[model samples]
Target: MIAKWIKFQILDTERQDWTRGYDTARRYFDREGSLDVPYEHIENAYPLGRWLSDQRRAFRAGTMSSTRADELEELGMVWDTADTAFAENLAAARAYYAQAGTLAAPRHATALDKPVGQWLTNLRRPNGLGKDPERTARRAEQLAAIDPDWNPGQLGWTVDWQRHYTGLTALLEAGGTLDGITPGVTYRGDDIGRWLARQARDWTRPNPEQQRRLGKVGVKPAARPQKTAARTNTKARAAKGSDAFTRGVTALAQYIQREKKTVVGRHHVEELPDGTSVRLGVFLSNQKSRRDRLTEQQLAALAELGYHWTQ
Candidate 1:
């Protein structure tokens, strides 16, 4: 309910060194509204500054005092540090914050922090707000403002689309470059984001990766992979409604029926009469997987599948 954070709006400029302190405070809060800056950065001359910094991080990390927390409640945050869920999230936030590199935070602050939006999401999810799509949309907009050319998977930590953006934020704060991360994890934000905007977004393809998460409960991935669709369409278009596709389809179908043997992954890439190439059951190419647009597997797996594509 407090917009512009009532405290930041009114600073005590009469104090010496107030300008630099306020600027630093304002900048820190402006991005994520969390405190927990290293104690060294605190302008000890102003106790108010230090308190403000601590309070924000405490709130973001779910370590707030009861009285201060009540204020957040009044703002309709559904906040609660006592909940195990909140504790788990706070723990994760602290870990991420501690690893954060060179990013500004209150000097001597020990607790790692979560971005304010992330903090709110953790707070809200336990309250049944359903992870707030609008919040993610806003975050994407913010990320776009940060880097228009951002490609997902620059960090190569996970396949989750949300992680792509979250990792981007962390990398920026750490002052790390894309080159520092594992390779081949990018998608046009425009495409990948919409893919994430849908429900069941955190997904792993079972046939591709044999992920157990989808079947663990009654959940499926948020979206069918865009890569899957593109790969399929490319094959179809390359087929061009020609008899070759019919023949290939018929042959592949017969191979399955006759072999009654399972090939772990796609066995081959067929260059149809058309310019487009058709991967037996996927878009993967032994020579082309792990290139951001597509995912590949171990060399042993590729070798087992046997290559069939011709130039």
Candidate 2:
């Protein structure tokens, strides 16, 4: 009889603990509107996140009671966190597509306050969607519904090319004309004019599907500029001489000013006062290796910036 009484007391304590966890979870649900709490989250000094994780583990292990599971589900407890995360990211992607008209987001792009760019990039990797055939197909279908050309590589074009094309499409849809998109013109951070000029210069490069899409948007290949051979050669030499040197110096100066340091990563790009960008680190490295070829003016510029290869 004493042993029975002790067992009853232990069961009562377990019930109280479970009830307390449930109450805390309900409070969290009311505040956050979802039970998708971070695994390390705390609520009012309680380890609510760990408690929720424990509950999920218990449910999966078939140790949790049906009544308890039902109560938690009432508060929007999602057992499959992978599915929940995928759904949320899909919504964010859709939001991005609605605004950008394409899913070819840059690696640093964000949408709906989510890192949708990285998410899409990860999805593009092999087996990133999942190993399950059915699930992969479902996810692919959903993405395709948002933008048929979301995966540009599968369609024989680069993501950057698709990004620019989409930007052009967005411009056209907004009633922008082709003539107004000059070299300096930009849309959604894309240099529309420069890309159009390249497409015109190499009109035969893009596949038939790409050509059809361009045609559908009323974009025709433009005529190449006619230049005299002597003039072109002179300009080319000049472009390689003073202009390139000045641009590199300008970029290095800008980088030093902005970062308050001379150290630059190999991939760093510095924007110049003229709105153009230069790969300053690569330029500096190249100049340092070819210091023997630098003119007096170029050496003076580097000295002024406190950049000395000998040091």
Candidate 3:
């Protein structure tokens, strides 16, 4: 493909080389930003191709002398390695990223003619080349120290700790510690990072659908209390109280004062003929039992309040 274009591609019509080809290429090749002559020499061959692929690698990458140009002119054609090398390196780059467990190409990888490893190494920041096993071991030691404080199998995991967590905070909620933490059931940090990029329009832009999905798997906001149900007049409630009903109300009020929100596994509400309603929000955890039973302490409290216990 390039063979056909190579002849005219190097004509240097305005004598402009890599400079003036693209603004970025201009700054990179020559900070001065324009090739005075645009003729026979442009260094840093790597940027030449990816930065500007069509112009026979911008013609600056393999600048031919006028003598060589005239000779080629006499011969009516000249072969160039620019395309062959680009194809080989393009294939190489694909293989490199696939094996490296990454999906991004190096930002600075502006050329396709060099060894993929050369420019690729420039992008492995914060964890260069994955070469140090000792570093990994030390990080593991740090992670192992965090207590696996919460388990999420029952009553669902509390998103309280992670409500406002950034990536770092979220990581802590997931593993309890940064270093000793387990990889997710099926993902790692790199995997999550990639997935996150796709989930949003941009890092800051909002996407409602993505937000809903992330709320489930990534960052969850703590649940706020649902609105309490309507109740009958106070006089109605007071007159309908059986001894059990009276005790339950006092116990529930005390429970609410102690904990802002009631935590209940088994909840019950009853309405009397006079329109009095009594509700019981138990304290036993749903995570621990399918059936709700009062604790010994709770049973004692009710008994003291003149409520008898029965199956």
Pairs clashing in candidate 2? none
What candidate 2 gets wrong by more than 4 Å, as runs, is: 1-66, 71-78, 224-311
Per-residue CA lDDT of model 2 for 40-73, tens digit only, reads 4678888786788778778888999999999999
Give the lowest summed-lDDT range of ten residues in model 1.
302-311
Better of 1 and 3 by TM-score: 1
Pick the winner on TM-score between candidates 2 and 3: 2
Q: List model 3 lDDT by residue over 102-172, tens digit each.
A: 32332333333455544333212223223467744443332222212111111121111111223434455
In model 3, which range of ten residues has the least summed lDDT?
Answer: 150-159
lDDT score at residue 127, model 2, on the 0-100 scale:
63
Q: What ranking emerges by TM-score with the best candidate at the front?
A: 2, 1, 3
lDDT by residue for model 1 over 1-311, one digit each (tens)? Answer: 37545545553332234445545555555564554333234343554334444445667786656775664344333333233233333443434344432112122223434353335322222222235577545434433343332212222222233333344445444565433433433332223234323324434322332233223323346445346555888767655644443444444444445565434256665454556555555534334353333222222222222222210
Better of 1 and 2 by TM-score: 2
The reply for model 3, stretches above 4 Å from the true place, is 1-80, 106-311
Q: Model 1 Cα displacement at 285 (Å)?
A: 2.9
Reference-based TM-score, model 3: 0.19
Model 3, residue 258: what's the lDDT?
A: 54
| Candidate 1 structure lDDT | 0.38
